[model samples]
Target: MPRTDAGVELAGVSVRYGSAKQPVTVLDSVDLRVGAGEFVVLVGPSGCGKTTLLRVIAGFARPDSGSALVGGAAPRPGRGAGVVFQQPRLFPWRTVGGNLGFALARHGVPRSQRPGRIAELLERVGLPGMAGRRTWELSGGQQQRVALARALAAEPGLLLMDEPFSALDALTRERLQEEVRSLAGRLGTTVVFVTHSVEEAVLLGSRVLVMAAGPGRVVEDLPVPLPRDPGTGVPELRASPEFARLRGHLTEALRPA
Candidate 1:
């Protein structure tokens, strides 16, 4: 199993784009700490640096100022976390198993052990026996599932998702949301998800961090106490009064001031 003790810490982290003389700050002195095995969500309107903060945690982009750490060390690209992006971004030339095999190879798994690992990962993501299917042959939801399975191939301690289900149909989105929440709990993996929907944030996050635009900073850090055990269905949770209250609070927080 992947290490479940990896947490995140950010202190005074900032990012800027464009020339120094005419810089556009994207994140301003953001301070955050995500505990191990916690599901944290980032939600806000456009231009609020949600993606930027995700990138920082993934080590894809360095902070212009301050510090960002994952598992108590500076994050390095492809090091300690798995990332799922808005698009599936699978290799068109590779079959479902081929794609997952690539990830396993990168993680230094032996070739002899790869087939079993690939099967296990596919099963975990609800894609059992899909190793033979071509990437183009699968539906959008299947493609995304493959993308997710690929990310989990190495069983990284931390998973970062940037609006991963935004393009899916409503039913598919909801299903995937439940799968992710349940999977994270079962595996004890730390998750940091980014979404524009307040409902999604409340549904999946143990802690929701509401961000604001204009140099992008967190304005509200709220805990969600809803039950997320395997037996708790999404529909039941969504209809609960506590869910309604948390959703309303996050929605109100995003409104323009």
Candidate 2:
């Protein structure tokens, strides 16, 4: 059931692409509700419209039909919602600090405040002194941290992520996931994350929404009762009875009969 206090709500949402002559449905009627300050992960097989749902929440794409709300208002593109996509998507020409400052500037943050905000954000994401460094000079993980800082600078109510860690190595991926979990908790920011990895979902999300293939739709939405910490690694989690229970549950829900 959809609740007003939910950080985000998607009711009977659907998205379609392609020309009218050859229309294609990417997402079927999708009903999802992410509570305030809740971490919700959307997981499904590739091309299951996981990203499409995130975009809708971020207001990047208008659903062909149905309701999509962020923080109680209609989805508004590039506003109120901050997004971190798969790639860092930083401007190659700008230094790390400058990239974040630009984001603040766009939101009308004063010039005097931009520097402090940039520094504080960088420090929060563990990239404290790399402000002047070009984005390309940093490692993949570092670049993603910068991206997180930029997104947070906007002080968005909802942070939408689309496979933000898919490109990192296994170790780096795990490390970033822990950081993200901690950061989101600290900021009390709501997040709607999209990922193909179940381990990542359980580790970072309070609730995991599993989608089925083709014209993707939510098949299962389950709460993750584990502690949100990096100490919960894939191997350690897999060994735990709870992890096995969740894995088996989601696996069965995601599989097509």
Per-residue C-alpha lDDT of model 2 across residues 31-69, encoded as one tens digit per residue: 888888899999998988998888888888899999998
Pairs in clash, predicted candidate 2:
none
lDDT tens string, model 1, 89-108? 99999999999999999999
Candidate lDDT scores, in order, read 0.95, 0.85
TM-score of each: 0.99, 0.92
Give me the candidate number with maximum TM-score.
Answer: 1
In lDDT terms, which candidate is top? 1
- Candidate 1 Cα misplacement greater than 4 A, ranges: none
